[model samples]
Target: MYLMSKGLWGAIAGDETTSEAKEQQAHAAIVLNLSDSQLMHVIDSATAREAWGRLARFHHSHDMANRLWLKEKFASFKYAASSMSGHVMELEDLVMKMKRANCGPSEEDVCAVLLRSLPASFESLVQAFRMSVASFSFSDLVSKLIAEEVRQNEAARVEDATALYAGKRKGKQYPKKQQVRRAKGPSGTCYNCGKVGHYARDCRSGRGPREQQHDQSNVAFHASEGFASDSWVMDSGASAHMCKDRDAFEEYEEVHHARSISSAKSNVKLNVIGHGTVKLRVWTGHAWIDARLENTLHVQDLSKNLFSLTAAAARGMTVEITRNECVVKRGGTPVATGRKQGFLLYLNADYGTECHMAEDDTELWHRRLGHVSYGTLNATVKDGRIKGATMKTNVACDVCATSKQVRKSFKTSEEDAETRESSRSDVVVCSDVLGPITPASKSGFSYAVTFILMKSRYVTVYPLRKKSDVASAFERFYQDVKTTSGTKIKVLRSDNGGEYRNETMNSFCKAKFIKQEFTVPYNPEQNGMAERMNRTLVEMTRCMLKESGLDKSYWCEALMTAADIRNILPNASNKNSSPHEMVFKKVPRIDHMRVFGAQCYAHVAKEKRKKLDDSGVRCFFLGYEKDQKAYRLLNADDGSIVISRSVTFAEHSVTKASKSRDTQVFDVIEEDESVEASLTDDEDIPAPVTEEELRTPPLRAQNSSHHGPSV
Candidate 1:
């Protein structure tokens, strides 16, 4: 449209008679295609002429058009372009003419002309038009403008509807003026004067001088006398009353007595409450009041005003309210109630008043009672002769005698033995053999012997089947003890048992370079180490067996378990250092230990588990594994034992009978000699027991059968 308009004007201004000019006019006519009447009106209007000049200037200089002219022209062209209704079409037209005269149009110049022609209502439309023209093709520019106009109208309509519902506007109209309401003031009767219209401070009928004076005087009087010389001043908000110090209470007693006589008396009783080693009941004439007693008391009004009255009162008074209550009483009457507030007490008083009151009360009370004075008295003796001399003796009591008792001395032993430090490596191993195939253990093997290291005091035990298996027992003992002590057996100390003197044992020790240290035959105490270890192992085994309430068959388990415990437990012979520490250089953690024969819960591993399992297996903790981080467990249901690292112990799960018993026994023994023989043979060593060896008879026949036969 702009091109057609500009082209027609250009043709008219140039050669009107030429065919090229006529052709341009014809092209403009076709593009314009306005009706004759509309064209005539457009041409006759002076506004159109002014609009053309404005458009021309906007295209050349890019200045703004008059706002009034833009508004009127937009109103006239509302139907032609809704978006351009509030815009000055003449300014835009002039820009188009200049652009057509120059060849290509400048977008910035066109935007400036359009913006200048835009009225208030078309501001958004003009912005939309500029953006649309810049971003879209020329053909889409007009369509986008029209669409933006429709969107703007719809948005305005929705806004008006929302405002109407919110009671902010009626329809799409806005009011020229708005009114606001003012806030109201508070209303009520005044507390000071009981006036309905005013507040307390503004009350006209003021308080009287006499009433005010009385209040002031009352405050002053209370400030001066409310807290007695001995009385503790406390906040009124406190819930319970407390008299902690005896001195505070004593001072209070003196002042209270004086006040009791001076006031409108009705026998007011004050019971001080407190708790300590002993309960105290202080009865003074005052009423029971509610207050709280703090553990610490601060007397801001006095220097060194705090005292441990609870302890003093406990030592000084004796009275009862209720067993749980810390109450003071006069005569047999109850005066105070509640839990005893025991501890220190604090009070505020003048130094002079405290001393004078305490002294006067002390003198008066003594005179009244006619009791002997503590220090001195002013009483004069008749004829300068003191009569009825009073004597106080400081005699020692039962506690003093008991505490000061001394024990009689005894002579020291004359025997002196060599003393020297020795490691396990330097020790001659020794042990006593004592056990029998008693009652046949669950594994069908029952025998136990104590094995001790002379240097390190480390010990072990081996269970056997028969005395004849002594050779085999020695092999088993060597395997266990050697691995534990990590040392070669250089010497073997033992009683002169036939087992130790056997050719096979002597030959084996000689071959191994071990010096067999044997005591004289029938004189066992010479091998005191083996003898003592034997006694110790027997004692431990007895304890274990008694504690477990099981038959002597499990004696092997008890022996092994006891040996392990003893090895770890501190021994006096080793300067209270356990064998484990002497060897391992570290204190073993005993936290995971469980009592022998204690019930234990063993977790079922995936390999051991089957589908539909409901519960875990129950077992007894035998002992710890020496080689691995595992525990030796004995399943009671099955005599077979298994080593596991995962198990929960129920230390308190001992049965009634087991608890009553004093001993417990849980033993483990290698049941098959053939297996042991095979192992020893595989190591290129002689079978621990040869068939011929098994045929040996007992050296000493079970004579009296004392504790069965000592192995």
Candidate 2:
């Protein structure tokens, strides 16, 4: 038919006398000879000549069916170790097949399909590749895949070695507690219940102690009253050698089925991350002795690391406590010893003065240390920082997604070294403005400025009227620090923001003999103290707001409260010393503290309300008033904020059932396109003052009528 269209009808018929009808018949014969699959590819063609050309070009006589098959194969291809290269080849083959079918994928599409076929373990690698994204090519991708495959094989080898050598030996199996001592009758029949083949175990009438099945329930993590991070405390009370630190284990196994540890009151299902030996170095009166703690329980929701005397005894080691110290001896020779501290014995490790966390185990160690910053563990948790921390960065932890407001402040190796070499506390201060935080704070302040002394990690936050107020805030902060410490500030570090580099700031710094270290144009990382502190404060504000089920207007109270907490949190500079103690030379008084956002009854003075009237007004504990001996409370009844020292708190009454959490309410500011109106006078401010302080209204709530303190 194509020959006939090109006027080759007579020539194609092998005779000049051949008619157009004969040429058409020849074309029809060729079309009919094609397979059904090939016919389908050219089924839409108008003429036999057109059909023949279409079939030859696209599916190569069956291109449509082949294209469909190839597309399905590309979509369904998955990775297999035995044929990873083969899988890649298969994808390439599909590309070629489609190209022949005249419907080939683009270069980018080809690369994407190749990556998509890799196994789950390649997920992080692929994400990392895309994230940094220096270059992307098929060759580069295949090279990376091959390299990853090699690395995985090497890791597998290492893991196998660890399993062979470090893995714990399975213990001897004992008879089940439910197993009956002996069959009741010689015939193996129980007369008690008249059941055959079931003697005493299930016999209800038989006199034997029945073992009760233990039920494991999940427990939420609570802040324990007394617990250390890295160190272990000797305890006769502990049922096992329990450790909360996930990174403490040299090896770990995840728990699938529910398992638990039982207490007199409740049974907490074991999270059972995995277990391995902890290398324990005990300093005796003479020297340091090394002992390995095997079969340790790496469970969650634990505060302190407990070394059980019974577990040690079971492991063929003898524990002797004499002369205010505990000694562990194996085969009558002392292997480990701990000096007594109160009721518990303590053994401080010689982890040395270096980076404690390893490069690879950063995330695991982060989880182990209870999702707090490396330096912020309380009294009971040990500083398990091992030597030779090889500078791992940006390790993400799921537990820390909500909990880590302070974690970001800890400097990386380069930053830490630079900070130490370049700056000193009180001598240099880093200050930055945080926001025009939506739904302006009750004080009508939309922005906050943070001031952090480089030396102590001590912070002071001031509510800002506008960005220009930063200079005045700094003046106040500088004066306060100068008066207290009697040390002149040598430097002021900040970004090249207008607030910091202004004429007022320059004059103040000049008069104070402070060298201003302005970070190059747009880099906030240089003024990390101010930026990180500001971010941490905001995050804490958000978390508290969400937790309290309060509206966003109370960000001021939350920010102020965060500032107070930050001051009291231990600084990395000193051992067991907080910013409060470092600057003020005294432990911050925490006894006066009430739960932030807890429901409380603030005492109403007799002068304000009648004797027969309510003596107390239900309020939300806002925070403590600065330099005052009273709590800032938001009256639930009238929405007025009052300062009162006399308040009764129902801290435990705020249960999960009673509190309705709007999870999505976090980051409450809605995005809008209006030029600056969305930021300044946005609808986020629930404008009209309402009865519930925790409800919508912003600036007007705290200004409402409040009962005066008793005269």
Candidate 3:
């Protein structure tokens, strides 16, 4: 890559033409990717490659002191049986880093080190490696090791599946032929059968009708449970913007111990740390729109950041959610939008990160929380509790005012009551289409569909190119769920979309002996199961995107990740069990879960990368790969997504902050090992400026040398 006009490259190019402007942009990007120390010396380099070489030299020299330190760690490392590949990957990355510094071992030397790192269980492989020619390179050894690792992982997964299904089968009831009933007796009374004498009193039957059926009603409307991570939840149930990050406030006024939130059938006492203005960053149609949220309640130790619909409605703003983004409109004009992440909706990229806070007043309580009845206020005052102010409200699930009595939105009666019993998995399923997400996903999908099982509230999502693909998606999903659960789907419910009402879908369902139920043409509530599922997946997908610091183009992957996490979480209707447990009959192992967007190193086999290239490639964690016991990671270098069981994650507690794009700064959130590589931004790196340049006169012309550093 020889540079043309090399002298003018590193220093900013002339604004002579559009091509020159692009070259200047490229030059700036190359510089911005440098770290603070590297930026100091490379600032005067005459070409991008020159600056890069200088940076490499600088980092190499600095990395020297720790060379022996890394060597010792490599020798002493022992691969853990639980995650041997991950351990080996970390060691390999360390070796690569040391090699870049010109202070690393030779191929044979590294091969010996890798063998030593193996556990006793790999002693057979160790012997095999030892007996081979000593000329064998580290890359070849790594390939063999990785092959063994993948095989072992597949065997373990198969064992787990076998054990789970076998145990499940031993307990599940399968239908058998019914016995013939004896002649009817007086009033059809029978001792064995509870029915009016359809059978004789002494009638022999394997089962008795009088025995009460297993009561599954107890699983309904259950209480709350803890989440694996404290991601924000955009809840229809929450009354106001409830936040845990005190740094997000523009103003604050702490109230003494207040416990206003009630969920999961238990009361959590999160004292109102303060109330103030918080700015949330949203995507408005195309660009970012920073929206200032007022009257947000900051609570200490809160599990999630909640954005209330009631608050948005109060401010004359409307929130409309879609598959790719959440749109907030004012009088039908879309003003703000936020991409979805796992189970949360957010605008600012760093929504939960710590930010600054100022002080405020207690009067904002009555000023904000909602529709306070004076009678209830008096009761609260006498009871030594806080009371909110009265306001015209539409919040049926307001968080702040739940302690007080509220007016009911609707009365429960015959018409509104749910009559069907969804007591078995896949007995009743609902599905709906979500989008035409403008720029399609990596899979070239512009639309998506959601299928929810009514009994367990378990969701399965499929990305689609168009609504027409609905039949194919359903056929695939039907086979997967049926094979996994060993149960046939009884019925499917959806809106009257042509995709669902068409002959293809109708004929397929009819052939399977499955019923198809349709909600009225314009009534979405009638198909609420799938409607709510669509919302949940979108909300959760936005949270994952916001958390990962990735763009919206990855929404399909984010949605899949969101859906997976959601299934493992407790169902709102049944707090005691998660959808995964209900459907799969086993608790999911969530202990191995890492943050969605954490920095990691994925082991690259010799077959994948060049021999001299790094043994591991830098990646950002996307989510777990479906149907495979591996992680789904995006190659940060090329934007290609890959799945691998051999990967190492660098975990750290990242600080969250909210800022407008113009002033936003990247917080190098990673363990020291990966910080340098993670700091490089592909765009928007500010050029280094000196005090001399700052002091120069603005009127200086193109020839003034005093202006400094200009090409």
Candidate 4:
């Protein structure tokens, strides 16, 4: 059309002009449009008609060779670039060349060729075109193709804006408007490199392909920078709370469905592997509150953790967004708070050290929760009573196995009652002595007396130096029960041991108006409450000592810890409520509990040390103090007990050297004499002997008694 408008068609159509100047004008116009190679075919021509004919015959001749070459070129045409109009124009030019050579295809064939030449990303659209019964003209196909191309580009831009806005609201930073304007070209900004002159699909430095899908779905990205493992951003537009940290979920269920979240890069889809509840320590302005987010999706490829306000609202949480803050509340209590920065609301939540326990197995919680029964631990977590605890799989705990082993029960005697239920705290207290333990404690104590309240099952254990000291221990326990519960003990039940059957214990019980009940001789099961408690405490002590690599001398500390932990755990006879709760009337908080005998560092006060001295002393965690809000620690260097509120623990570390200890047994040897006359020197004390010694010949009894009261 352009050549005809310029009156240059006359030269190519072989029109003979009478005016020489007009003919030359037409020839010059055609010559100006020809390339150097085309000009070479007509270089020797003397007239416009001759030159036009020579060029036509060489380029688009009606010959078999030219027809086959044009056919092959048209069939092999492929669209690889981003521009749809350019590709269509190239294909149309090939069709026009074929027509000039007298071998052009039909319009329907041209339409088919055009669809086939398009890239694989347009497969869906191409299929729709092919499935149509009505045939399309070449021009109609071109219009539809161009329109679809425009629609796709528009959809991609909208998706990009949607993703950018969503991510910006999730604390993602993008280029400022002024910066974008300065950097972008007349076309637009590239999403890949944030640069000018090209689209993301055409960018050279893109991380991956950014091809648009034919369906034109909206893409959303949580963030564009990188993975934010520790922090969370509040996203209102998100459908679910998405997290990349799988370990952060306290309860999780794997997803079997093919679920995914589209990213800002359209080709990238973040797969959702699971969903679960995440327990967070949400920081309010003044303090931290325990918050659990349910149905949080775990997407391993998510760039940032996102908390969905919509999801939170669905789960009964109230989200209030003001000009500068977002406050989240559940049941009128503030659970989480976020501060607005620019357009985003970033939550002040602590993933905590629990998130760092990615490799932590079930045994870690078993140790941290004070070696509670595995069934109880799992039930607590499953019931949602315990937060920030996960049990992915079971792991064998040798300490628990060895310590919790028990012998089969013997048949109950006819005199023993089937049930002994107490009506109230301190109404009936069960007391029993558990020693002559083989190795004496560091404080030179060899026996422990346990007193358990029959009602609450709350236990108190006191280490004693001698069996006679049981009276003093019971006196101290009596005063404590009176002082704490303001109740008088009505009955004291114990076995027929001399410690409790003696005149001193009888007189103390009579003065307090407490009835003293003794079990039959050799039937310890009659005082089952205290007898069972004694065995429990001993087992706990053994486990803690064995796992901690500490010496048997620390048995007293371990026993005390065991009693403290037992008080907080659910009692079998207490209807699943902890003994502590039964007595104290409040639920005990076990979040502060740590693994027993874990390696720790206790801080030293400034006044207690010199300027050059170390600020902290390495220690071993013993247990908690009953009265004070402090942790009891044993100084590793000096073997001294240190009480401090500020202590850091390394629960994963263990002292390999002290893990094993040879089992030893000792006998309390005594001559026929009074208790006072049995007091002897240190050399007279019997030494611990191995099992092999029992197989050897028995040694003759010595006439001289050698002892300093054997422990």
Candidate 5:
């Protein structure tokens, strides 16, 4: 066997150690004998020195070669270990520094250095090392190294386990805990007998010792000879003694036939505990009864089943009784009193009669009182006051009729016509131009024109520079009126003038299919609507300008303001409905109207004002608030037109005109110069003198003089 083992050992050592001494040593260590081929195979397949060392460690012992090799490798291994240990300590110090700096090592830095140097199987090596040094301090650098190595090994193991598990087919299995029922013992001992063997339900002591002291025996007592069920039984919860059986009740009725006790004819159904509901006829009356069951009847024990006596039964009693401690005195005496108990009674009395009771008496009082309809209450009072009087019938409230009368209807012809008229979208309109007064104080415009609508009497006025620009003025008028009225012009009427006869006016009329209605030369009456509007606007403007003590230059603003007011005011021709209302189908809301040229105050928005500045500026109220956003004002100090939301008006100060009249005078001179310049430029373009013009200058009596010489 020794020889065979030596041969096996020799084979396991491999061909690299072919020396005789080595072979002999290898052979000595082996045990079992083997054939040459088997020996050779063992030698060829022998493990490396590191593997042998690992095997030695796994077995908790070192073989001869492993011990010798370990001794030799110890120095190099210790060096590597010391170097790695130093690196670990440095890494820990760096980590502390990083923590102090509130930062950690970058993932790339960790991966490239620490992870790259670690062995492929380093995780397993680390786990084995950690198991060997399990009691080491985790705060030490060596422990951290081991822990990191173990974590890597665990991650590798998890990956392998996950892959293995994922590759397997799923199985159906119930959880172990759910497959069985756990057993438990009972909770408490019986209190009645002080025994743990049985529950309270099986105990024979009836009740605990403390509860038996107050028990009372049931007893029967006779109420009266004529009362139903003469032997009255005492129940702890029972109110006054009651018997509801039909035969027994009939017997009581016969006995009390002469006592004036009337039984109710109602087939009233009442709930009886344990017996369900039973139909009963109730009898109620005042009577004296003897009490014999006092020991069983405790005064404090009142059942929820009996509360107040029913209304019918209460009324039937000589004096009605209730569950609450109440006594209804009609002529000043006690009627009834008792604590609530099982079975309330309904007394028999006049069907509609009411027993006065306080609202706080019982739930029944609240319920019955709540249902007592005011309409049915036959009591007389003034203004909800109640006296001790009965009413035969209800009275009608005349005050209600006077207070709730319907409003009178207001019907008008104008409203009817407005409802019947075609919408603004379906109308054709007409208008004409009218004025040129002094230049406006604001725009330097000297003219104002009237635009009149023929279909609806809607008129608008515009200020202009010159009547010579009449075509442009007409275009402006058409655009403004059409935009406001949402209607197109079908006909236009005007007098013949070089301005009106121009190609611009003719082309516009042709394009729009507007029939140009003209008056006879020098006649203005044909365009009566335009003419009348113009006259009215001019007069209103003149009056306003004169009253304001301003130059005629303000005629434009005055004309516009007057036109707006006139269009909104009720006219006699339109049946007191304004032209604006007739055209727009509704009265324009004029609640925001202010006096023209009146001083007014306007609010300033935070965004538009400085923090320290006042809220509004002083200005004149030129017209109504327009377009719902801004007020148009003439800045009296600058003669400048401004639209703003920040202004304060001193209505009385409107008389003060700005010191800017020089601007208006300059504007007039400039306009005259422009007209003269245009005329001069036309003259500069020379034309040849006509022959008829030269011959006409030489006209003489030459023919008559020649005839006299021949004779």
Candidate 6:
């Protein structure tokens, strides 16, 4: 351009004498820009064109070696500078150099290289741009990347100025989440300014003058804008509150501490940057209200905000957690509520408008009520007999289905039905023996017999040491019934087992004028009432043992408890009243009924214990004592039964104290016919029927002849 302005183009055309002068001027102009190395190559040139060609050949050779070197440098270019604009300028300079060497990459290749060279933080943005429909332009790509880099640096600076508090403050109410410690040394990066050597609290460039007064606690705080979510998860394991949105903070202040916090769902470290009170629109059951979260750390790295139960409790908020929900209250007024989702509990933002607090979950109520049937549960709720208890229909319970599963019942007899109408004159009773249960009872009794009064459906259990003891047990039962009620024994219906059909039982029955009606050989359905009772007691005991986490050895205690419970429960035959009410001629009081195997503390009288001894003994509630108002309690320390009237029960706390030696799964008890009975009865045990089956009208509908005893 300088030669052309000086009218030197005529020098290459050999125009005139004056053109030679122009050539000289043009050559000088070209030479002034070249170095000594380049000037050496072009010194012998006679014209400006020759000198320019020689200089170009010397520096920008188009040979394989020159092209290969330039191509390699361009392909291997990496961004290393702290300034994004400077890095792009360096890349552009390299591209121009490559073009001069005639080996520059295509525009697409350049764009790919630029994106591929960026840090992982820009991966999402790079992917987004790659997926867009817009045309690829190197200049536009560079401009956007530089703009993104500026945004990241600005955000980092702003967050760094905000004080970060990390690590959890130990609290009494809940266990703290594990803090993953970062390795400390010269390699440790300062969390504040992304520098080395000093920690974020000591970094001079972190928060201007505020870094000097950073908190010393080993807490961390970082909130990543890319990962933050709107919903807050309730974390019982967390000891401190955390949030990702800085705008959510009602009051903010800077602090300095560093530690790693992770969610139960993920192990990614959430950086803590600042602490403040975060106000949230919380659904407090009845209304949507602003709940202030005090000392909430701003953690941009967190995917979702965290509401810590431990932190809430420390602030004097009462947190009541059931299986399905967590209710948080201050001064008995609900301030926040969390619904169970998967394994996490999430605070519902629209709970006031959408959430329905109808009833405790039916499954939970099922467990709480000792796995009772939906009918019993509905009745319990409808009668308002149990406070705070409710039932929802159609909710299936796995435990109930598994533990209460029974074989289909046999066809009932036509003339001698299993259930029939009964009166005081009919004084009929059904009897059955259950056991040689494994891991024999605590009292060493391996067998038990139950007597069901035909009319009232009142059940009574007698623990027996052996099969032969059934006869003696029956005599005792008969004597008690005869003395208590002047109703003489009329009909004793039972399976044709040696325990009931033996000579001793026959002689006693003959003397008492009690006709022994045995079921046809192997046809236990004829005596289905007794057969069904055995299965019902066993199933109930199995559920109670499993639910209470008690040992199988306590099956006998559970059996007795089940029988007592069965007596008070409404019978299918007598729709209006329970067996206890029909038999005792008074409404049965269930208010004193506690869960069968609940933890309790029985009071020790001064006379029973020394002055230095503890006044209360930790025990498990067994059942009510038959003769008195006292309760049967098993001493947790000694395994001995304690009868006490003064007992404090904890029904809600079902502990898993089952011993490893005890089988976890309860197998249905199959009658052990192979074992020598010491005597055999000429009868085949029928498949057992569950209590629900007997009560269900479809299977055991009342016969047209008469209604027999309720199973």
TM-score winner between 2 and 3, please give it.
Answer: 2
TM-score of each: 0.34, 0.39, 0.37, 0.47, 0.32, 0.44
Off by over 4 Å in 3: 1-417, 420-425, 653-711
Residue 105, candidate 1: Cα error in Å is 55
Measured with C-alpha atoms, the lDDT of residue 335 in candidate 5 is 43
Q: Which of the two candidates, 5 or 6, achieves a greater TM-score against the reference?
A: 6
Give the alpha-carbon lDDT of every model. Answer: 0.38, 0.53, 0.50, 0.60, 0.36, 0.59
Q: Which stretches of candidate 6 lie over 4 Å from their true place?
A: 1-369, 410-419, 422-426, 608-613, 661-711
lDDT for each residue of candidate 2 in 1-711, tens digit (9 for 90 to 100)? 335455645533357576767656655555544433355666566545566566557745345777788778767766432323334544665676778777788888877777777655567787887686476776667656644543443332211111101111123222233432332453567644556776544555533232223323222212221223345665433324666654455555655544454321223233454456665556655687655677777664454565655456556777666546677778998776766443335554443323333345444333322233433433212433233233443455433355433321232566556655467666877777777777786667777777777666677677766889889777876776677666577878877878887999899889888898887654555664555455456555665666666767777777777666556556444456656666666655433444567787676766778757876687888876654456888888677888876566555344221246554333422122111210111001101101112222111101111111100
In the range 1-711, model 5's lDDT, one tens digit per residue, is: 332434434444356655666555444343112222223334432343323333334444334654554333322221121123223333443443443334544534433334334433354544554467444332332434433432332232211011101111123222233322211113446544666666444556555452422212111111111112212222111212333221111111112111111111111112221111211212122542211111111111111111112211223332332332223233444343332112212222111112221222222111111111122222112112222234433333232222222233233345444532332222433344443444444566655444556545666554556666667666765665567555677767666656677889899889877777675664453443454454345434444444344555555555555655555444434534546676666654322333455555454445657977654455565553333234667655566666764343333223535433332221222111111110111111101000110112110111100000000
Collision count for each candidate, in order: 21, 17, 30, 4, 20, 29
Candidate 2 worst ten-residue window by lDDT: 681-690
Rank the models by TM-score, top first. 4, 6, 2, 3, 1, 5
Between candidates 1 and 4, the one scoring higher on TM-score is 4
- Highest lDDT scorer: 4
- For model 4, the stretches where C-alpha displacement exceeds 4 angstroms are 1-337, 340-347, 350-361, 382-384, 388-395, 410-417, 422-425, 655-711
Give stretches of model 1 more than 4 Å off: 1-416, 419-425, 472-486, 636-642, 656-711
User: In model 5, which regions exceed 4 Å deviation?
Assistant: 1-432, 476-486, 606-609, 625-628, 645-711
Off by over 4 Å in 2: 1-377, 380-416, 419-422, 655-711
Candidate achieving higher lDDT, 1 or 4 = 4
